[model samples]
Target chain A: MTEAIQKTVQPIGVATAALETKRLSAWFGDLHVVKDISLTVEKNDVFSLIGPSGCGKSTFIRCLNRLHEETDGARVRGEVLIPGAGKRENIYAQGVDPVSIRRRVGMVFQKPNPFPGLSIFDNVAAGLKLAGVVRRNVLEEIVEISLVQAALWDEVKDKLKKPGTSLSGGQQQRLCIARALAVRPQVLLMDEPTSALDPISTARIEELVMKLRSDVTVLIVTHNMQQAARISNQTAFFLMGELVEVGPTKSIFTKPKDSRTEQYITGRFG
Target chain B: MIELSSRDGVRKFSNYFWLAMLCLLAFTAIAPLFFIFAYLLVRGWAGLSFAFFTEIPKPVGEVGGGMANAITGSLVLMGLSTVFGVPLGLACGMALSELKKSAIAKMLRISIDLLTSVPSIVIGLFAYALVVVPMRGYSAWAGGFALSIVMVPIVARSTEEILKLVPASIHEAGLALGLPRWKVLIRLILPGVRAGVTTGILLALARVSGETAPLLFTAFSNSFGYRGLSAPTASLPVQIYTYATSHDETWRQLAWTGALVLVFVVFCLNLVTRILTRRTV
Candidate 1:
């Protein structure tokens, strides 16, 4: 059974570097939230950032989308790049619009805030709507395909008219995923997406994450080491706002090169 | 047994003490309403007639017509006030909620607070000097301008409070979707707080509906039905004031009817707004 599972889970296809950060850091006032963190995400792969609370895994993930800007004397003297037009686009360029950046790199927050005043259909179509695609048929197709991609279409197919917030917590998170997918973004960021869910819901989201690896590059921030091992192809462990180690999930768990990685994996201290 | 009795005695006395205090506070809040309502009902009772509604106030000693002129003028002024005040107030509220850190928002907030605390009588005088005297006469438009001054602050402050109550997570969600800030506010944030805005508008309407001092200087007193916005107009509260002070039995009765109508309209508006807020959430 183990051999068969290994064969089925073997890295199926080629991957490309989708996003990379060099010496990225975040700060609030004078306090460093994420320090000198550097990592890379490849296409069609699930890369998980995991650490204890205040270790800055979430901060690092937020920085990828430029959510946590270094304000009040806080500075990030690094580069974050996304591949564009057969080359890399430096996202930190002075004139680049963060709004446009966010459209290409979508994020799902920790709590399921799925545009409470909107219908389930509209919630999925928010980004497209924002980008000014008002065609009904096009919106309908995108909403359907995105929801299916997020594995939530079967449950919400008949209730597209209902408010998005009416769904259960797990379903709401999936709806948020679908909402992000509606824009057909190249990279999808999830910040503690399953921390607010029950165990069963968390398992379902993990399975969904694994499935989504084929369509969009995924980078998730999580506190659950077991979840990282289950869903991610690669795991990046963080400590004190620093990227301590990053490698294949299996190796990171079974044979970590760094003592801190081993300590964290073995539950010695976060 | 003595200890048990002593414990029971302590509990009973404390309970009674709290109960008495609660009752006193409730009574303190309600006493003025009870007395004023009772007074209005008794004194305004005789003026309750169809003629009372249709006639215009005449000379103090003589029988007059209903407050038809006042009623119509009040409706027209309040309508104009709502139109002028609600949107500006809502826009100010949106600015405060969405652009909280901006310098203009900070300045506008201070000004709104000042506007809210400025007395209604002062607003009336300001309108008279700014609008009525300049226009060379008291008119429904001037009255509306004064009422809107009172309304803008109430609507703005209440709207700001309501918008603030919406969770910041909602804004984050919109920003995450890559929607521009303006689009997020108009599409997502505003709809979420629609009920609150409506409630504020209604409350503002109630406030301006009963104001007598402002209209005294702006709408002044139109004994006969004025035909245009440029001419002086009568309103219910002003009619109530003039008639209630007169010795004529018929004038006083007409004032009672006008009072009843004004109170009923305000009450209905309040009830509907409350229900709307409840249903929305």
Candidate 2:
């Protein structure tokens, strides 16, 4: 089963960098949370960010989509660039709308948040409707495709009309993934997407994330070091708002250069 | 051992005593509602009939009469108030919740709080000057306008409270979906708080339904049924006030019937609101 899955989850042949951030810094009021950091993510690669709690890993990914600065007192000073239709576009440029930036980058939160009042089908269709796809048949087709891609179609096919909250915790998380996928974004950001689930659910989400690498670049923030070593092609370790080290997942786990990275991976210290 | 046992017995006696006392206090608080309901039912039972709902009041010496005009008039007045009050209140509430730290929001909140505490008679006088005087006569428009003012503060505060109860995470989730802020509010947040907003609207309606002071100087009840929005109108509260103090025995009996109907309507509204809000949460 594992070998067959690995064959299907092979990387799409795109070696160019999909996203680049230069000298990125963020602050809430006067307290700087994400210090100066630079990173690059390759197209169709599963990149995992592993760090201790409150280490600014989540904040860094949020900056990629401009969601970090949505808080009242929050501020960001950085250059985040994404691949546009034919050119690289700076997301923070004067005329660029954050809404458009967010549309290109989808996010799955730490907890499953399928809109409470919406049905299973509507939850997946919400993004398309917002983007002005009004045809009923179009919405149905895209919703079905997205759910199938998220690996939740078979379980939810007969109960699409039920409220989103009626699903189990694991199913709800997959539903959220479908909701994000329905928009067909170029990049997917996950903030500890499996921290709230059981072991079986966690494994299912990790498998789905691996399969998703063929279509979209994945950036995941997780505290689970084993998860980072398992699914990620490249892993970045953050400590105290700084990127201590980043390298191929196998090398980072086997022979990390930085003492902090080695200590954290060995369970010596957070 | 005897001394310790006696002390324990004393403590148990005091605990029972306090429990009984609290139950008595709770019963006392609710006793008047039952008394009023029972009195109205007993006094108003004979006045209730098919004609009472379908026919207008008769002259002083007539044997058969009804308060049909007052019933329809009250409906018109309350309906108008809801149409104006609910939307304005909801808008103000959204502003207050979204801009909680802004100076303008603080000022508006204080002003609404003051408006809520202002005497209803004072509001009646203000409406008398604002609408009745300008229109050159007392009319149902003036009455509805006055009741709406009374309703605005209640609706606004309750709406703010209820909207605040919605989790901030929901708002964040909507925004993260690339939805514009307005779309998030309308499509996502509003639907999430629908039951709470409905409850606030119903509570405001119930509050304004029995307000006699505001209508006294504005609508200035007419003996005939509703003529038009520009003309004077009769309402249950004002009609009951007029009949209860009259010298005729028949008018006083009809006044009790009007009171009973008003209470029943408000009771049903409150009951429905409670059920809706309970199920939503």
Candidate 3:
């Protein structure tokens, strides 16, 4: 089963950056939130972003999926490249539809936001339906697979018809992850996904993130430095809208690259 | 210690006094609804019969009559109003919520507020000029148009408020799925606020069902059944107004019956809205 899973998840070509951003900056009207910063995320890598409150980590991840500019008066000026079907495409290029870009990059929010109106099955099937999949058997199969991948299938399999919001906070968050995975996005962006959950739920989500690294590149924003150090292979530290440092998670935590990074990791100051 | 205890006693007394006052105020507000319902039942129950619901009104001096025409006409008018009003109002509301920071949205919000405050009678007059005059007579279409206008602001304002209650994160989640903006709105945000939007629409329908002033000049009164959308229609509220003010005792009784039926329908709609909202939440 493990070998089968690895065969399905392993990339066809030599591993390269699945997502690359150049001088990405975002502003909310007159307020410049994300400063000019560039970063690259390797294929199948679990990359984590860590920062204090209002450090623009969330904004930076939102920009990857074109969700940041959805805000009123919010604007992003940057080049985001994603590996398209056969070639790489610049997401910010003219005529590139944000809709298609979003389809390629799925996102999970800070809070569990299962569609309150839909059944658990339907919640997972939403993106598939959006992609125009009409066959019932196909939808059922995909929904089940996605839920299993999110580690939520065992708990919710018997009550697929129940409302999505009926689940516990942790289950609902996993349901959201399932919903995101249903679309088979190349990149999965999560913004503080486990902050609202209990410790066990948080641990479950952390385990799921590790498991997901084999299938899709995972980019997560976390306020918990320990969470970043635990799951992520590559870690980026941001402070006051700037990328302070980026390195292997072990080096960033143990070896001091920058005084600010060291201070933040040590619990001296945020 | 004495001073502190006395001050606490005074504060506690004031709190109880305010609670009593608030309860009294609430009862005062609710008292008239019960009294009106009781009076309607007493006045209207005796006139209700199988014939009262299925047969047309009798000629003058007749004792037995029904408001069959008025009931059907009210349904038709309400249906027409809903068909015209719901889609337009929902679209306006979605636009307002999506483009909240735009100058156009701000202007539209202000205009919708103004429209809500506009009297139903003035809307009837406007419909008179727009639809009635063009057709050369009062019409069910004109009446429906007036009621639809009245419904628009209520639906739009309530929808905007309800959609606004949905967190921005939900919208981002949908957008991040790569669905187009319209699809995100129709599939996600709209479904998220389904109960609220339904409640708003039902409330608007209930409000318009009780409106007599708008139907007065637009639908006018027909003693007969519906003669299509272009013809003058007999709505429950308008027929009730026509009959209640007449000298005949039987007509007045029928008017009371019509009022009772109208109140019942409105009450049922409100109940359904409440149930739907509760289930969603």
Per residue, candidate 1 scores C-alpha lDDT tens digits across B1-281 of 99999999999999999999999999999999778778777876676777766766666677756788888888899998998888888888888876676788889999999998898899999999999998999888899999998998889888888888878777777777777878988888887778888899999999899999999989897878767988888888998898789888877777777787888788788899889788766
Residue A267 lDDT in model 1? 91
Chain A only: list TM-scores of all candidates.
0.91, 0.94, 0.94
TM-score of each: 0.91, 0.95, 0.92
Best by lDDT: 3
| Candidate 1 DockQ, CA atoms | 0.56
DockQ of each: 0.56, 0.52, 0.59
Candidate 1 lDDT at B84 equals 85
Q: Second chain of candidate 3: TM-score? A: 0.94
Model 1 chain A: lowest-lDDT 10 consecutive positions: A7-16
What TM-score should be assigned to candidate 3?
Answer: 0.92
**Candidate 2 Cα outliers beyond 4 Å, as residue runs:** A1-15
True contacts kept of each: 0.57, 0.45, 0.71
Q: Candidate 3's residue-wise lDDT over B1-281, tens digit each? A: 99999999999999999999999999999999999999999999998899988989998898897999999999999999999999999999999998887899999999999999998899989999999998999888999999999999999988999988888777777777888878877887787788899999999999999999999989997998888988899999999988999999999999999889989899999899889788656
Candidate 3 stretches with Cα past 4 Å from truth are A1-15, B1-26
Worst 10-residue lDDT window for candidate 3 chain A reads A7-16
